[model samples]
Target chain A: MDTLTTPQVINSEYLLKHWQGHRNLTRKVIDAFPENHFFEFTIGGMRTAAQLTAEILAMGAPALKSIVDRSEEPFSENRFNLETKAEYLTKWDESTAAINANWEELSAQDFHETFNLFGLYNFPVIQNIQYFIDNEIHHRGQMFVYLRALGITPPFFWER
Target chain B: MDTLTTPQVINSEYLLKHWQGHRNLTRKVIDAFPENHFFEFTIGGMRTAAQLTAEILAMGAPALKSIVDRSEEPFSENRFNLETKAEYLTKWDESTAAINANWEELSAQDFHETFNLFGLYNFPVIQNIQYFIDNEIHHRGQMFVYLRALGITPPFFWER
Candidate 1:
């Protein structure tokens, strides 16, 4: 009897679904901000809302590109320094759509292959997707602190 | 030459903070979840809130055990199957405290060293923290979707 259990596998479909879920949750959080407040607002001397939005926008394209090309240059934050929230949002939407478009292209076999992401060596495809969504939520967690600090109530986590 | 930027090092700290921060965040998210829903209300066949919580609780002790012993068992999930959420939460809280305590024990030298987690291979301490927090957020993302689908609002992302 083969008592060894198979490892749980996550398909691209699952990754894309989770990706959109983060985007939708984030959109609601972003909407909670006043127009002017969106660009400013910080807690614990961390990145401002606009800056964090830029960070979120920056993750998708660069990450997908990094995974696809197997580049390991530590995805540059300088590449994401944006001037406007609209630009960030637009970029975020585009990135989200791009991931959804290209996700299916990621084969099940690719899940196990190692790729370099930001000079980080030998990361598998699943780890890459894990990193992508985790990055967003980490910043989103920061935004949550900022939102409450600013006396704003973000959408309930389930509202999305 | 010591050319690495301050923000780069700070980014590492940021990543570490994120690991601890979300551990704290999980405590709050768990509070908001009514007990009944703990094992119910999964989105798209994702892990249940209870299962997700089990997964989070598993991160430290088992992984650390594996690392310390250099074992390849990946910490059996069967060990996690227990009677009540309270039992799991107690373990989770204990695990969280253990991580903080152990985190202090590590010096600058220990970060880059490999430590076996999940029987795969040991990652650097910094990378391990990233994996720690990122894994929590992944399941939390699933919880967020479940909350929405069940018409329950998860707490604002940053009540902690």
Candidate 2:
């Protein structure tokens, strides 16, 4: 009798779904900001929400592609010179599709395998993926404060 | 030939470990703040880092205890009136131990079960757990900016 009692809780598909949920909420945060404020607003010397979004856009699909291809590309947030809020949203949608495409290429075992993210931090691929999600949540949290200070109500955090 | 090819990428133990890593990093963010600034610092009308820490402290173990005991406790951050940074750290350590204690009471199946967290936000137990982690990362991100503004180098985000 093989005595492993617990069922598997999270698979690759579930992880993608979890991440996409956060991405969706983040999109709403981008939409909530005024057109000018998205790029120009800064509080307490932090980067504007648009700049932070640019960093997030730089990560997801590119990191997944690196992990999938075993490529050693250095990290850069300047791949797209997005200026307008609409342009940012377009890039965001493009990245979302790209993430889905790249996600399909990952095997389950690949998650446990280590990948040097952006030729920089060498951690398990799963941690790298989690970092992508965590970093977004971190920035979104700042954006939430930004929204609040701007007298705009951001989306409910739990909705994600 | 049953053809489910992917293995489980995350289990309850892994989830706990992941959350604990973020918690550990967050502890460092708290420690990085100056004694007077921890409670007093604010930017762009945001709450002080101390108040944000209060929210993180209020959630973790208490939420787990709610899930374990099947209680509908309304959320409150006033359980401990931590006046100093040291007191907050002490409470954080206590909560860390308490989170472990409450975690032991949760069976693997409990992660999928839905619990109305804090008499609000009816989400799966797993999501609630993620929220605890996400919420901390969010606040820590703010603290990071606060630290940077005050000319202090916070811990590297990737170290978690």
Candidate 3:
């Protein structure tokens, strides 16, 4: 009778688009910070927005690579020479491209396969991918506050 | 020759647990702020944590019920008599229970189905669910910055 209803969660294509959309907004967030404040400012003992961004990049770039490479390792807080704001942007852009390319290497079924992230929290690939997105949104939320405290207008959440 | 690989995302049970883990961490973020600061503080022009929490609840509680009812509506930023911190927490707990009950009414196929979220974004049920999670992480990130600015210690992100 073929009475079983079809599965309805967004397809893999929508997932990629949605993720990239969020990434685009994050880039705008990176651009909103002032040069000096990006690296030096700290409120309430948290890492500088630059440092947080680096932490995100550290996880994002490597995590996707690990998924494709079938290898897992510990998450690092910083990567390479991001001493300057411009340098950070460069790294962000590089990571963005790397994400898209590596993203293509994943098959729909691969998303359901389990990959032990950071040698812990062994969840499905979809959950792991959401972790990457969730981490970015979380860090960007901090940057939104940083931008506001600096008397700058952070982009809207809906903008993502 | 069953070549179609199995989907690996944690089923609804794990999804609920994962969401609650993050919610528990967010609740701690709420507790870290002082009585007065909980409602009044803002960084970089973003909504205060209380307001952000309201937004999450506004979407979460209704969205689930709508999913169960197969209806869609625009999202609001505030709900109920969340005038005080305690009230907000209570509302959050209420929403949590509502989410669990409504979640049960949905089938696994519903996760893949598209519902015009907020009469705006038309993504799948899974993306919408992720949005609920991502939004919490995002707002909590801002709260982390706010807590730091106020000289209060925020909870660790990994605790989730």
Candidate 4:
């Protein structure tokens, strides 16, 4: 993808490509997480590792859908009420693929239109796509610290 | 703080209380993100630092709204498209206050109801809250790395 385009220049293809990149990166990070630590690490009363994974999996689709539909609710407001890690992961994968599948459903014009995203404010669809990507990156940064606090070399950031 | 309670047992107050903890922690980490870095860091093919903050600020209120409405779209699907550090931080502060103000709107039974969260699937509102906190933790994990990569010492995790 051309690296010089502004966020407003991004389209469904850019979003799908970036989404896949994020999913791939997330998988790489998850692979490096020690199973024991997965349920046990805490930094100042924060969540356990298992809980973090569940959180990532949980928001994958809702956030993407919100960006796509330009809906006015937080992504977490709608949840599966999941009972298992497997379920959350399944949804995560499905959401990744959904971004690819639904890319075409979003018109180029949609990218230019501004959305309210819950009466919070309005941004172009393209900026929203960039936000989705940036969001994943921010979380990955935290996971690396989790690994380091546990003394692990997280997979290279570029491997994803 | 009862670790024994299943996520379902935790209501919005529990979630909000927990999230407040996350905010405190993240605030410390955010402090380490140098004013210059706040809008400028990049690793491999990733978003600029300012964009990351915007995503975080954008998600806060919308995510809560989604939980409250049990809606399928992201609360940010269209509300914001910030480009400056000042804009993002302003929004972030607004979101933080919004969370504190409206947290009481949630009832314990609200935790039991399933939410669609962008049609990704259904998860209890309670679990979704957990996800939100964990999500913040995950992203904060990324911020920690950003700080470290920049050769900065992050505050004590507990300091949050």
Best by TM-score: 2
Estimate how well candidate 1 is docked, as a DockQ score: 0.05
Off by over 4 Å in 3: A1-12, A72-74, A107-125, B1-14, B71-76, B112-123
By DockQ rank, best first, the candidates go 2, 3, 4, 1
**Model 4 stretches with alpha carbons more than 4 Å out:** A1-160, B1-11, B75-78
Lowest summed lDDT over 10 consecutive residues: which window, candidate 3 chain B? Answer: B1-10
**TM-score of candidate 2 chain A against the true chain A:** 0.94
Give a tens-digit lDDT track for model 1, residues B1-160: 1212111112223334546666776776665677778767543334577877877777765665454455567565657675576776787777767765555555444444676666564665445554556567756755654555456766665433
Each model's DockQ score: 0.05, 0.43, 0.39, 0.08
- TM-score per candidate, chains pooled: 0.51, 0.89, 0.84, 0.48
Candidates' chain B TM-scores in the order shown: 0.78, 0.93, 0.90, 0.79
* Candidate 3 residue lDDT tens string, B1-160: 1111233324566677778888888888887888788888886666777887788778777887877787766666764648888888888788778888888887767776778877776877777887788788888888888888888877888776
| Docking quality class, candidate 4 | incorrect
* Clashing residue pairs found in predicted model 3: A8-B112, A8-B113, A9-B111, A9-B112, A9-B113, A44-B148, A112-B8, A148-B44, A149-B44
Q: Over the stretch A1-160, how does candidate 1's per-residue lDDT look in tens digits?
A: 1111122222245346656876888877877777777886654344677777776766676777667666675856658566666666676777767777666566556665777667764655655665567768766755665566567766665344
* Models ranked on TM-score: 2, 3, 1, 4
- Put down candidate 2 lDDT per residue, A47-83, tens digits, no spaces: 8999999999999888899999999799999788998
lDDT of 4 by residue, B22-66 (tens): 677676676667778876875543555566555566566777776
- Rank list by lDDT: 2, 3, 1, 4
